[model samples]
Target: MKAEAERRGYQKKMEAEKEREKPKPLSEKILLQNDVIFACKDIARNSLNYPDSFEVENTNSGIDNQNGKQIYYFTLDYSGVNAFNVRGTHTIECYGTIGDLSHSVTHKIFN
Candidate 1:
């Protein structure tokens, strides 16, 4: 019974450590600080020939760590006119880190 109690204590400690290591939910202010919106707008401008007529709607976002580096993921929905003046929506997935401004558009879907 003593050994079992010790094992359970160790397990509880391990569970608490795991919970502490998990990433917390990102806030809108942090997104702005990371320039996520600007990156989305830049992508829209490059993809579509519109003059700032596009609207950026953030569908989802998350934070993760890779190789000890904090990486940010964003999914944005853009609604605006295309190069041919056809109105449509675009879904863009972006991932990058802070400080270097190294954001990249991973995927884009036209609708």
Candidate 2:
């Protein structure tokens, strides 16, 4: 019985996911620090599982300081992302793939 219930739940989840992927007229503005702009319709889907991703290179000093990594990590609060309303702090406590690949900070975001 548990297995059957799980299957039904999985089906519903899949349908909901498909519904989300349906394209719609873009709306909503994402505000980020510095000169970079993050729009809701701009990012890509995370193939592993994350709905999307926002990468930043910390090259603040225009000219590379010879050995500086060239970019810095920032935070983004994207909790309010969805079909209805695209605005709110995200549930993201951190960023990156599975298994402690590497830890990094993030910049906040809005819908």
Candidate 3:
């Protein structure tokens, strides 16, 4: 029983040391509101019909609890005629974090 207790205590100490050596997530706020907006606009222009007719709207930002990262949410509104000569509007919902804007998720809300 004494040997077993010492082994368990040594394992716990090693585990604690490993946890302390792990790298922590960045705590600095590096991205600004305009940066997120610009990234969204760029994505919209590349994937939508008319690049010049889209605008960013309804932007919101919040900190994610799981990873302690800033998450930005916004919508893109496009109003113009497509290649089919049909005039209509489109809305896209987008979200992304500071260091991962290029991989932002965009979903077409309506068309």
What TM-score does candidate 2 reach? 0.23
Could you give candidate 3's per-residue lDDT for residues 1-111 as a string of tens digits? 999999999999999999999988644244444555576667666666766655454444454543776565666675556788666666666666655645455444566
Q: What ranking of all candidate models by TM-score puts the best one first?
A: 1, 3, 2
Q: Please identify which of the two predictions, 1 or 3, would achieve the higher lDDT against the true structure.
A: 1
lDDT of each: 0.70, 0.35, 0.62
Spell out the clash pairs found in candidate 3: none
lDDT of 2 by residue, 1-111 (tens): 999999999999999999999987532211122222232213322311235433332222121222433332333333323555443333222222112223232333332
Which candidate has the highest lDDT of all? Answer: 1
Error of 2 at 107 (Å): 43
Cα-based RMSD of the predictions, in order? Answer: 10.5, 18.6, 12.2
* Residue runs of model 2 more than 4 Å from their true location after superposition: 26-111
Kindly indicate the candidate among 1 and 2 with the higher lDDT.
Answer: 1
Lowest lDDT 10-mer window, candidate 2? Answer: 27-36
Give me the runs in candidate 3 sitting further than 4 Å from their true place.
Answer: 1-30, 53-69, 98-110
Q: In terms of TM-score, which candidate is strongest?
A: 1
Cα displacement (Å) at residue 54, model 3: 3.8
